[model samples]
Target: MTEFTLIPASGAAVPAEPFTGRHLIDGLWKDSADGATFDRVSPSHGVLVSRSAKGGEAEVLAAIAAARRAFDAGDWSFSSGKSRSEILNRVADLIDRDRERIARIEVLESGKPIAQARGEIEGAADIWRYAAALARMAHGDSHNNLGPDMLGLVLKEPIGVAAIITPWNFPFLIVSQKLPFALAAGCTAVVKPSEMTPSTTVILFELLEEAGLPAGVANLVLGYGDPVGAVMTTHPDVDMVSFTGSTGVGKRIVAAASGTLKKVSLELGGKNPQVIFPDADLDAAADAIAFGIYFNAGECCNSGSRIIVHEDVAEALTDRIAVLSRKVPFGDPLSDATQVGAIISDEHLGKIDGYVREAQAAGAKVVIGGGVLAVPGLDGRFYAPTVVAGVTPDMAIAREEVFGPVLSVLTFKTEDEAIELANNAAYGLSAGVWSLDVHTCLNFARKVRAGTVWTNTWMDGFAELPFGGVKESGLGRELGRFGIEEYLELKTVQMRVARGRNNWVAG
Candidate 1:
């Protein structure tokens, strides 16, 4: 094991008491029917963060019933788009006003850098504003080409009661990705945030109430996947399920939701790649590559965990990325100076280390940082920013989602070979290409199997662009106009304007 620089916790104040989180049902906040509760200790700070109601079948059932009633009664589903848009915009404003507070809670709960959490809060607010605009711009198509006797209309309507299950990695941002869009589509929802981080969602619910969102429009249940998430997926009343998590768990959600045959939209795992060419700007590519792998401590679905580089620049590019990786701050997340923070848990830290060790045992060379990090005055778990070289396509570290600040480097000779190497994984959520030539960038983008392809950039996302995956990466899309469509259903209406419809019977 290597000893790296230790970062001590900032002397910032901790909450005197842990936050109290309860279920929000029918515009009321209450405890679980059985008085069950759970607690979250900060993964970075080693202190209690929150205590939340543990929702079981009874609580989940209540939330589903509330959403179903809210949808069936048309209180929100039939409301004017302008009304919904106004409320969404107000929520956006509220989010911006409380961005710092929300960011602090997220940092404490998720063990991510404070700066990154703050940026996510800002981005989440922007998504809310975008969803608000989407609400008003939503529309139906009218077919005027039909004969004068007949008119056809295609209407987009809310899918009704939706069950939204968000993961813990990017809690606030992920929920913002799903909930606002579902509401913008005029659907009521039962939401279950990961039990590990539930306070921020509770805060968002407060903002929703303050924004004048009607009762039973959006409900929250805090608990584990079993009982809570399981019921949300299979319930007879749930019209749709939008989930963001591991592909394995995503498969389970699909199978469970199949019982009801409800609509399912998933944003799952990724073993994303960034391909570097000989003609690429080495300096720029190296910088982006380092950021891609270390951002979110590489606990992101879009983490650029593996790099496929042309043989000509393989050694030089690998050295540059290795040098850059060491410079990325890995320490206490509370300090603004820290770039990478603690792993989510001791178990997760072990899982990340296991992948690296297995790769090393299989003949992979670690260029730098191949062990645990010791941050002063903190007992929380943290892994070093590792760079493994000589990684083969068949190696697990190169093909699997390591979900840590670990980078794997592999080499290729030709463009086709690079594309083949990039597309070799079972997951294809995203990929990036680095090249100055227009033809190479376009050709590689066209050949790649990922849902989102970046040219000369890695993980530059926007609210206007659609995001999702193909194959085992999971199904459907989120964000942009297509995102709102996930919560909607289409209906065709044909009318006979001229006296009466043509009759088959003898007149």
Candidate 2:
């Protein structure tokens, strides 16, 4: 038995009554037609956090119809760029004003550290501000050099309505990444956040209403994926679908949308890697590796779950990370001192531990903590930060996404071997290299198949750059200029200034 130090629960006040959430169809908030609702128990505190109207086929249809009607009405779709930009900026200001309220709900429902949740809210606000900037700057092309008698014009228009489905791991942040951009493109939308964490999104809708968004321009449904998300994906009225979740679900969305042939954009799972070379700054690399795996309790889609290190320094680096892993606080999410919080659920905690146990059974060695963590005075489920050494490229722990604070270490003797090992996974979301040699860094960055590659850093992101994945990781990109384009359609207009076209009909 391994006895671990746990941070005690903080004195932060829990609400006397759970939050009540409902479906936002058109511009009105209403309960489910059948009056069925679901409750969310805080994963960290074991207290009732929220009770939401469980949406079914009827709610889904109603929301979709609202978005379709709004788009067709052209009230928002045909609005000037300046108008859309102003609304988005106002929404951003509201997000900042309600930052504490949203962050607290996120911390309670998602079981993430309070500080981290606050940071995510801040990041979401920044994304909204960036999307506001994009609204006014969006433009099409024009050509006057076709000929003296002819002119050409290209125009970008909104893609009717979009269905946005987000996951539980990053409820507010992920929706912020998608919805504001869709709105900025002059598109109406129906959004569905995960049932486990729907209150933050509910708060966002309140902000949207306060911002004076046109009625039915954006609607929200609260529930599971089957009736809510399935209808959204296959609905003929929807012009596009943007989802962030697992790869299996991503594939299902693609298949469901095939019948209607609606555009589908996904940001899916990852088994991201961080490769270390002998010439790297070992101390800096060690600190980053520790942060990468432990951050978010390794539940991030871009989590660096595995490391491929050169043979000469593999042992030393692994030891360093193991020591740091033990030092990361794992306890109550309400505590500002806790770095790693409770697992989202007992089932997910089991899944994480199962992966590490299987790897150890197959010849991998546990370098540090390897089992459940008991936080003082709390009943929430937690897993200790684990590092598994002697992992081979063929091991399941090395190839699959454990989505936990578990790190797998594998050694490579040559650069080609490192690249081969890094590319062996079914995912290509992100990869990182930590070498001081500029040539070495450049070579790896060029050769890696990931959507985002870091030379000496891990998980540095900005609103100006596009983010997504390749292969099974996902399809299309989000953020940057490309984000809004996903919700837009292009049209070309050809004109004849000479007042007549060529006599193609022989008239």
Candidate 3:
């Protein structure tokens, strides 16, 4: 590995390393069939980081074929739990070995705060380790007690070649959430990281090979979603598809996968809510709300972009929110003090701006910062942390996933009204409740229609818990033992100890 330094969007530098930016197929690092490549640049700065192989249908097919071959060879997916555990553990070790460099690369690509980026790297390593332990413990069930003359068995088998497509924000963390479990379940995979930030996984390919993952056990293809993503979902050779992105794209993948009737798992969009009751600690609630919407520049599927406050405390909470929102330091992604960073791309920046502009045009008040920020030394996409007051539940800014540093505040006179507003959206990925009263918090958490509910907290996760959504948010879960099961197919086996007479009609 050659030493390199990445420049943040604000032109701050941090030591890093360069990735080959090549596709890993069948244990080989190769360019695209057409020899095409796309530049991978920092979201913090518009500077070129490297050029990654631009893949499409051909690359997708190759990756799927490689994954299928490996799964069929039984060197991986059909191997014993112990054998799988050894390789999975090795991968974990490699991740920790290169954690610092990986974190730097993530900041270079995603333009998230260095502190959060480092935390994600550590969390990803923990996930791999957790999966490694699970790999050794993946067991089937048996019931010899069925009868003296009979036995029953329930087996969990690998679902074969899995196609994993991840998004740009929290690229490595999200991929780790899916891939490690697939590996633990003894499945081979064809992975397509978002074109914007595929370098981390490209580096993982190198590490997986070093960890002795067999050829085709895990393949990496970097490219745009159009043809590559479509190929993965529609390809006959793929046994399953796991995707993390927008709800619209998730639906598209589902429609395409229906052609083959392949197993599909999606972690989609979220217009998540943070509901604060009058009995809550207003200051603490404001702090959590700030972190909720501004973490990763609010480019998270579970971002709490919708703020529903009790009418009694709405004005007070709004004041604290503005104060805390301004405290979110912004500048170099590599800077330790930076809490929020640049937007992922110009396209996404424009989308965020449009939402704010439209909301303002509709009579919403800009309580504080509400537009793009121009950093003196950076050419990256940066947006100010914005809070919109007088927001209605039906407003576009209040209803949609802003995926930026923007929060829309709404007021509710009753608990029923709060729950109604929170659950009104088409998304149900996650939500948060901040209240000192146990009953109030519990009631809101139970009534809110979301996959994950945090009481007196926001956005904390663990490897032992399942993460996903309901309704338009997603299909299927990831994380924990259940996550690994997403890559497994269950089969029931029955046997008779003694065979009696058989009927001739059976023939």
Candidate 4:
């Protein structure tokens, strides 16, 4: 087995924090109606980071009213696309300027590796830039030859009062994915970020406000999901809802939105597959698999949790994966040498531990690092990079989303069986295939039932690509042009070219 050195955490100097708690509503920061507050905890040390206003029904309603007023008053929708694009570009620049600070906050609040947080910060900034460039390109179409004396055209206009709800994982990046596009499409928005990690979102709103967006164009509310999230989804003033989270909660959001027939776009959960063929580059395959499942402690919605390898090469691949998993250093996120940071909370840690225990009880072999690791001098939620072999498809860990640093290895007989096992799950969000053979790669890519397929790689994403799922994974799309289209409505206009107008009844 080849040993690889972990990249030391970057000790980059971060800027002095300029923004804190307080929600951004109507271009200003304020407390909730009842003055209730929630503590922001540092998942790295399990300490209180700060306190933010705990928004509830009254706060959510205020945000909705502000958004509705902004849309109906035509402050944002009346602006030209070029104007919107310019403001978005400015916001992107501001994000870049504060990237280091934002990355630090992300690392501190979410307990992700500093390196991964930096990448997420960069990705979020790029999404803003991409959405900015797309702002001026929301063009409508003109239809010719509708009739000899009639001219027709189709127009795309902004959907009013968008409600954006993002998950705790990739806090800033996921919110950026939807918020920038919503603003670019000339829609007013109320953002509800997960309470687990709201610091980055609060910083983002400060940057948005600094970008000089019109008053009431963007609002922020922080609270628990059930009350605040439900209010946002069910509010009549909210025209559309864009959410990213677990599939179980997504169904509830759908049910709530159905009452008013509100537009909805959900990016839900996944039990993604990483298939390794016999001809794959063993070293790269093992490394990719390790990073795919262990990165951010496998909190990603598109985490490659299931490993479907060809039976001939399954033993070799499993051995290599186990070796790699051992090398994944689990420690404080602030340490530059830490590769795997702590899980979000103790509840999530217990959930992941339960999955491992259940899988072991079901006769799966615990190959390496299958439980919690108590590091000296580190008091936080931590889980070791776990690998389970001899896992059957019927095992709970093999079928459900463990959402932790846990990987289940299953074998397949052939390419057809690999695709079958990969697509057998209820999720169709993301999948990865590793093969040196071009034909095998193409076949797997074409046959896989996932929104994003990586050939010879894993978890490589950009803001320019559209991402979502089929089946139970999600509805609609995020990022790229598709993201912008989600916040728009289409309308058809027709005009007659008669020289003299005459009433049909009079004639």
TM-score per prediction, in order, is 0.98, 0.99, 0.95, 0.95
Off by over 4 Å in 2: 1-5, 505-507
Per-residue C-alpha lDDT of model 4 across residues 166-259, encoded as one tens digit per residue: 9988899999999999999999999999898888999888888888888799999998986889999998999999999999999999999999
Residue 36, candidate 4: Cα error in Å is: 1.0
Please provide the root mean square deviation of candidate 3 (C-alpha atoms, Å). Answer: 4.1
Q: Rate residue 6 of model 2 by lDDT.
A: 71
lDDT of each residue in 230-291, candidate 3, tens digit only? 89889899999999999999999999999999999999999999988888988888888988
| lDDT tens readout by residue for model 2, 1-507 | 344557888877888899999989999999999999999999889999999999999999999999999999998999988999999999999999999999999989999999899999999999999999999999889999998998899999998899999999989999999999999999999999999999999999999999999889999999999899999999999999999999999999999999999999999999999999999988899999988998989999999999999999999999889778867888989888888888899899999999998999999999988898877778787889999999998899999999999999999999998999999989999999999889999999999899999888898889999999999999999999999998899999998888766787775
lDDT for residue 507 in candidate 2, whole number 0-100:
54
lDDT of each: 0.92, 0.93, 0.87, 0.87
Candidates ranked by lDDT: 2, 1, 3, 4
lDDT of 4 at 73: 97
Candidate 4: residue 264 lDDT (0-100): 91
Q: How many pairs of residues in model 1 come into backbone collision? A: 0
| Candidate 3 wrong stretches, greater than 4 Å | 1-11, 14-19, 499-507
